[model samples]
Target: MSAPCDNQTGGPERPSFVTDDELERALRDAFARRVATPRPLAADPAGLAVRRARRVGRRRTLTGLALAGVATALVTTGVAQLGAPAGRDGTPIVVLGDPRGSSPSPLPAESTAAAPAAGPVRPELDLIVGSWLYTNGGERWELTGVSTVERAQRVPDRGGWLLTSAVTAAGRTLWWVPPNGRPPQVLLAGADAIAVAADGRRVAWRDGGEVFAAGAVAGQLLATTRAAAPAGAVPVGFAGDTVLIRQPGRGGFRVWHSPTEDRLGTVNRDVLNVYGVRPDGLVVGQVSAGTPRRPCLALLDPARELAPVRTGCDPELATDGRGDVSADGRWLLVNGARNAALLVDLDALGSGGSGQSAGPALTGVVTWTRAGAALHVDAAGALVRVRPEEVTAGEQPFSSPVDGVAPGDRPVVVADSRP
Candidate 1:
């Protein structure tokens, strides 16, 4: 298969979330460093570097540990697997990473796994790739090929990529919030609210006004809920078994925790929507109860609601349930901009009250942090860099720190990376 043409050398084995100019500068520095070193070390330093690089590069290539950021490397392996179906032409599908790679030997558009009994067996929906949209009735299906320019829906309740769309999947037309909005079982009525994770299995969205969820399983009621009972304020997404509901009081907006299936909540009237969440009770969202429309997000440690991590901006709850949002970085405690926010001038924030940024704002940021490990994502929700404060000396179970691992789509295996 034809491979991507990346001639960059030196610097960190992998590129971090640096601006293109920064990357270019880094590459230049690497080149200068190579030039500065005495006569290519022993024989030819360039050749030696390639040998060393190939070793580490091959390791990164094999592991595929990084989150989805850009399409730089995604084209290497799966290009062969991207041939046109019976009817469609072989239009090169632009994945999460950059499309500068060489044309790949297309593969039969069939999944290595058994084809779903209902439809074509996709290897798996790359959260960064197009999604399988379903209708409320589940009768028709459509593919809104994913792109970076499109606007993204966001919701705080979910902890992943916010994949919001009005498309249909299978035979059903569904309105999803984020993450994987078009699952067979979910129906995010009212304003769309959904979020898909980097792993794909953990889908979160609003259903009938209340939060609900389903695993990547084709047809399973992961979690279900009614909007709100007694005409209480509607609920949004789900934080594990707890639902993020809007409370009712004077100008109320709160996160009233209820059983996974509970549609109602005790009136707290302090929280906004569950904008973003993580397995570790780190929940963030807007606080609107007292503030009303001027809502600000609060990051809650779910275990302790009163003292959640509060930010100065509002996080949108995406239709796909992925914690994809316009993390109004204008404020000190910024999350991330909406997936589509990338389309905006990276400097728009700076000139305006938003925030001043150099180059593409998305170019230099990390979206998620766990333990001591950090993964950086670009405008397209691809994981471009992995910064592990301490790289394990030997080969541990590490994954490649590349582009295109959108948040929420959790990799099933242990994520090992070349530190």
Candidate 2:
């Protein structure tokens, strides 16, 4: 797709965007280090370099032992399936980690399995190939036919999903691929910062700093309320009815919620990144290394109900761009340097965060769904699913990961069949 901001006479248009190739390498190196590095046996290491090398070799053996232990202890004893019940308000209830050994309950038996029949057969994975969006399945539809896909999301409503994207040419346009086997339809133009609600019925985006909401299936304009966001605030997501936005950092980073459009509070400027803000007002982001502080993952409950929790960050932790948090708000899929993912359990925030061996490393956007699935595009451009339990296991299984179409097919959106 031709970029709009290019200089006709000389230089290249648009700043450098990282390619999928670079991301794959980074993910491989990061995962290898996290899976194998051993804790120092001695309090002091005056001359144990050789022993450390040997310890590294033992990591593969240790991984096998760890997996065996998990089968015996975690699987047999029934460690909870990593979930929490919903709060009184319908948002998932988030409790602080016990640190004393108690853990949250496992997901209900039904959720631990594939999502109910009401959910989609599979979640769709989308990739940006110039301006067009192709589906690995389905009669491939080129969203714009003539424009580029700037951003896209699968509508969350289980009744059926609408694949929404911002198609850009001279100006940005909004469009949706309906579930009824119809061709892609244009919703509007000149929109940016588009986000779809969990139910996939509502779509929101920014136009000249004004945020607008519209019906994805009904084809109706919902609202165009003026936002009080600070200069340069961009609409990022929708948690239930609340719209989450990120503001550029001046001293401390800030995330503002709309309708109310109030700042989601943070403890300090050291909290330099915003991965996501939950419908319940929980903010997950990174705390940059600063004076008297080491880099860490910070979970800020803006309601002031819980103490702000910060766990020391891994030197390899990658907190670039934004990431996908699970529907229950307990699991988050993070992409580190080189397209590697760090799977974080929100309930374990006070403890050091956990890592996942996201097989083959993700090369594109990673997203989570209410169906308990984590989806992403791998380095080969193939769409894949990595189950939560598989991720928590922390080792590459001997078996192949969940299979899907390979790279170069178009994008797919996994959403429920439209009623």
Candidate 3:
């Protein structure tokens, strides 16, 4: 009778991480006579096939994910680019092989006081502190200007949200490295809510109950807070620095949150994958708490305001891209079943060709990022790394790894900054 979880860090949104055969079998029986598999993407080709069910599959069996990927290959959105590989939907996929991602901290969250008005806590901004990519050989990015609040109102300094700060920055640094704290007894630092930062000066992590930020010391705890959630909150997923969770207030609802447990947006609708959350704040979920039928994918917003995204891409590909985007919020590098892939910018207008041209070929699911928006194509000895800010519009923007090597083949994150 409680709300379902939508945490991106593979929370309830993904069912139970105990992806063992037992859990799978239990989940299977729960919906044995009620669930129905949807058609494959190959059938509609351009259109993505939407399946309906209360839960995709037990974490033990990502039957939905496997089948979904299988459908992607069979159906390509035959839609060409405006200028070939320039900005084929600028997206940033989840960076696999994240060094610090090695050890998951705990889950962070706040209790919903006694009453709803007992002062519901709000969310704040989460910053990247340390990681293998940054410490090894990359640029460090900081997350600042975040605070907590109630509802969708901005408080900026409610003091309930968590925050992290650094004293300096390094030119070649990739992430921050701390000194202590790593266990699963409480919450597993699984998935990602993990990163050290490119400057190698900060520490950020999710400690299950709530998010925490620190400077040079791991146990030094910078700040911590809970999500703008009700008493019965369900975690769906975690994206970039955000967490997707569901709770029961007036009724069942969904929303995006920060590591410190702050609400960024909300989805007041019903969906099937209520258990799914993408990276870019886009939710691939559903809620039938008060409804009478099975579940389906529903795009949710943090504030339950307007439609989530309407750009050239949106609700688009959260999982790095689609089922993908619900977590990272980009599509530059997406994760696939076999290999990681890239979303190449197709310029049908300029390249003067109708077919795919010579540029970059992502080896994984296409992912993207907004700040350092660069097209990284790792394929066929052609490393296309183009910073969108540096090029002119329609320049067939592309980027390949140093040697056109598929980074997907080997999760690379600028590691080497060790003792």
Candidate 4:
């Protein structure tokens, strides 16, 4: 039998299949031959990889340069926007953020840019120009002009200056210094007292008991009108067209209509003295005796028969008839007890708030500027600038020794026009 005939009469059935071990050996040999024979490469594989890397680096470098250009353009635009236009004379206008003298240093990589340096502090037009007049060393001096008179008053509108000189046995001679730099002209020969309007357009003076009102124009008086004032009345100031006359030995003031010569009304007798008048015709006064009994600063409305519009009382408030309101009628600075000054916010007072003590304990007088800064001449003759907004109790204002003023010399500032 051919291998015992696996199937019925199959003659060894079929060719014998390979064993499992033999098949595994054949597969391993095939794999070994395929690995031994090297495959064909399109190019040097290592060189191709290096070239690809170089191309990617070039692309990254180009992208970095493009981003830097965009950043530079944005910075240039920002600088142009911050710059201000030049003046007509080709001088650059001084703006708030412009660098002074030298360029600023660059900021650190992680730090934010610092705030711009503050510009130099400058006085307002009333303080800068010819308005500031003071006396020093027995000689008078205009802040911008030469020493000329013993006392000077600036016109509120900068029309000119009212100067007092030649005090004779008769009375004080009033002179008008024209704003155009012309020689001063004589305004009145013998004026006992003088008061200028808030607008500097009208002027009133007293020759004995007779009060006169005239239009102040170009350093000359026009349209003069005269009216006999109440007995013992002295011209103090002008509230619009009305003339404010204080009666000596009396505790109140009287309002006189200059044009009509009609005695309008009287301020309340409770107001001990009229310190000053605001631009809006409100009178600032002191009430020494009242229901509260404490000395207080009272803002009186003349239209309402001098009724108290607002009152701020403090035991330390001592008014020696030296006080003023800001031109905008917002601030009131009154002389206080112990040589200090009190700053009252009219808005706050109207809303029922208290006053604040301002500046150092100055031995000298405190006056307000048209720009609302309190000007105080300290004991050391330092011209101190007190900002009302910055003033707090027991705080000192900025003090600077004025040039040409000695350390011990006290300078008296011109009044009324500064309100």
Candidate 5:
């Protein structure tokens, strides 16, 4: 849970939450306090140095022990089998840390898991209507097939989706559901997290505490390249050819060029969590900085050390990393206070206008369609399309129900859905 908003900053304060590192430290200190007796092993300077090194190693071992205990507790309670819950408004929630505490070692490059048997492909598709994939009560649903995929992202050019299995003791399987509908091919196994480029031409994933990148060509992954990353790093999204890796429990992110494996440096110190990246390279995230530490939705320039290009501050607004920017980077869908979903106009916000005061908040997860309309799930789990003019005029934007799709399913539209 987030801390109370500070009036001095005119926005929400940075969430005061505990981190894994802090928890480990507390556990170590408590264990030390119970040591009952101290052995005198450091009378000489050299002996003291050896003792200090041993203590450090012991702390490291204790961290691993603590994480193992956490994993055991989760499995015992069946929490590990549960998927992340959607927000009250239907926005998907983003959790930062791996349940196992640290990333698993990376699998061999040739170690691809066997692909599942392919289903029959549809004869034709309406690209204009687009496609969306989401999981409903443990079933992964797409227009052409259904499976047990826990998370999915659209591969626009490939006409399919990239899928990841639910967390397991071994790790998650990364699969590619082809447009031709042959079957889903396994791209990699034992992956911790995955991120695809905006164009669907490139892909990146984290495994074994390292970040790997590869080109997505003709429904197949090209040769893979690996780069070392900081501890607890996970690939969040891509900025052009650069991969943006978020450091769990830390306020900043690392920008690394995929092809060259160059560490561009860290960014977004004031931004707590990133939602999405704009086409022009501006990062959309929750910023909590400036005098008095105001929290708000901000556009941060990655090249400028994450300086705010524009800020939309609202005292009542709160985000759990459950929002996204439109294809044109003009509209933003974010979950507002009281579970209200808001459609924010970036152009207006840049022109000295306010998003919270400009339009009424609706109830559902709102996303942008290819035709520039707002497609959302209503309270009854129905699909509703809203025109751009209706959003600007503060009028009721419900247009019609989307046909042939089940209700109560979250929809993921392509990001660049500009007219």
Candidate 6:
């Protein structure tokens, strides 16, 4: 009736339907008896071993592929970081330090406006006015504990940048200006002369014919070598791992490689004053040429074997060892005549003619502030920026403690920015 309720009724007591093929399979499986067959105990052992080995090889291959994929991902991540902005390049902004107990002043606040899309912000010039160190912004930082600063140099060491100063007090001392603005650390208490690596990672100082080497950070001494420096010898600079030293009036400078303290070489046998050392391992100095009163600037290789490259004889273009070579080693500025300053590209210093015009004659000492410019300190303690294009000098709102400077204010030393 009604086609047997369509085998599976839509009513409550519905019957389950089974196909003939399924019923047959189920019946066969329930009634069929399996035949007993002997399985080979250990078929060809070598064949089995080969099959097992193949499986292991496949597993190893898959694992290696996975590892390779991970490695590729890691390398890709590193490459991406490499392309990130210079802010990730480990470069640091310039900062100021004080010798007195005062901490390092905080860096200027980052501008809220969009930053310029450019490479690193070039460091500006730093000034050492009397016992005070002034930032480019005219902030007067006290050089608290130290007395008189003979020479000041901003150093970029491995640990961090430091403001390295050679101080003259009871005796010569080497003071370290921490980038964090911590109180100045005494690198060497009793030191006659000091030389810092342009990178600011290493320092070498001489005290009574003995030389000591240390890391830029405050800590124990790195090494000591007896008779490393001669009497009255000052650490002029560092050329790579070698330390260059010379007396005030010595005809030349000698080089001593650190750790081993081996004599590397001597340069400028007849040159009088070794002025500045470039980061590229070149040295600048003055030598007697033409006449005793007439001196010429010389570009010399720190290696003794190289001959001195002298500027064409210029009597007025004399240097008082009061100048600096640009961190890039492309520019050099030295004090010329009393009212004039000397400017020369290091690349062309060897070929320039005598008495080449280097801009207006500036009074007082001309100390390099940046690359192609020099900070001319007038007799009245006023600082004027002299460049290849123009001069920026005048009375402005310089931070206090400077007090617009007093009559006694003088530029005892200069601590300028470096690459």
lDDT per residue as tens, model 5, 86-204? 22232122222222234233323221333223321221112111233322212223332333344555566436666655566656666665554334555655567777776677778
- What range of 10 consecutive residues in model 3 has the weakest lDDT sum? 146-155
Model 4, runs deviating above 4 Å: 1-151, 156-158, 164-170, 262-264, 292-294, 350-352, 360-367, 406-419
Rank by lDDT (best first) = 4, 5, 6, 2, 1, 3
- The prediction achieving the highest lDDT against the true structure is 4
Worst 10-residue lDDT window for candidate 4 reads: 90-99
Error of 2 at 3 (Å): 74
Off by over 4 Å in 2: 1-147, 150-152, 156-171, 213-217, 228-231, 249-257, 260-271, 277-281, 289-295, 302-316, 337-339, 369-371, 397-419
10 residues in a row with least lDDT, candidate 2: 90-99
Evaluate all candidate structures by whole-model CA lDDT and list the values in order: 0.35, 0.49, 0.30, 0.57, 0.56, 0.52
Per-residue alpha-carbon lDDT of candidate 4 for residues 192-275, written as tens digits (9 for 90 to 100): 666666566777776654677777665545555667666566676777777777766755777777777544465456666666
Kindly state the number of residue pairs that clash in model 3.
Answer: 136
362: Cα error in model 2, Å: 3.4
lDDT of 6 by residue, 51-133 (tens): 67667778778767975885686477542121111322321111112223331234433223332232111125665654455
Candidate 1 lDDT over residue span 116-230, tens digit each: 2442212112222233322212222333333221222222333222343342332112222223322212222233344443343444444332344444222222332233433
Those runs of model 3 whose alpha carbons end farther than 4 Å from true positions after fitting are: 1-220, 227-242, 245-253, 256-301, 309-384, 387-411, 414-419
Cα lDDT tens digits for candidate 3, 32-138:
44436654333431112112222333432565576476456434643211111222232111111222343222322321223212110110112112211111112
Candidate 6 residue 146 Cα shift, in angstroms, is 2.7
TM-score of 1: 0.34
TM-score for each prediction? 0.34, 0.54, 0.29, 0.58, 0.57, 0.57
Clashes by residue pair, model 5: 104-208, 118-182, 118-183, 327-415, 327-416
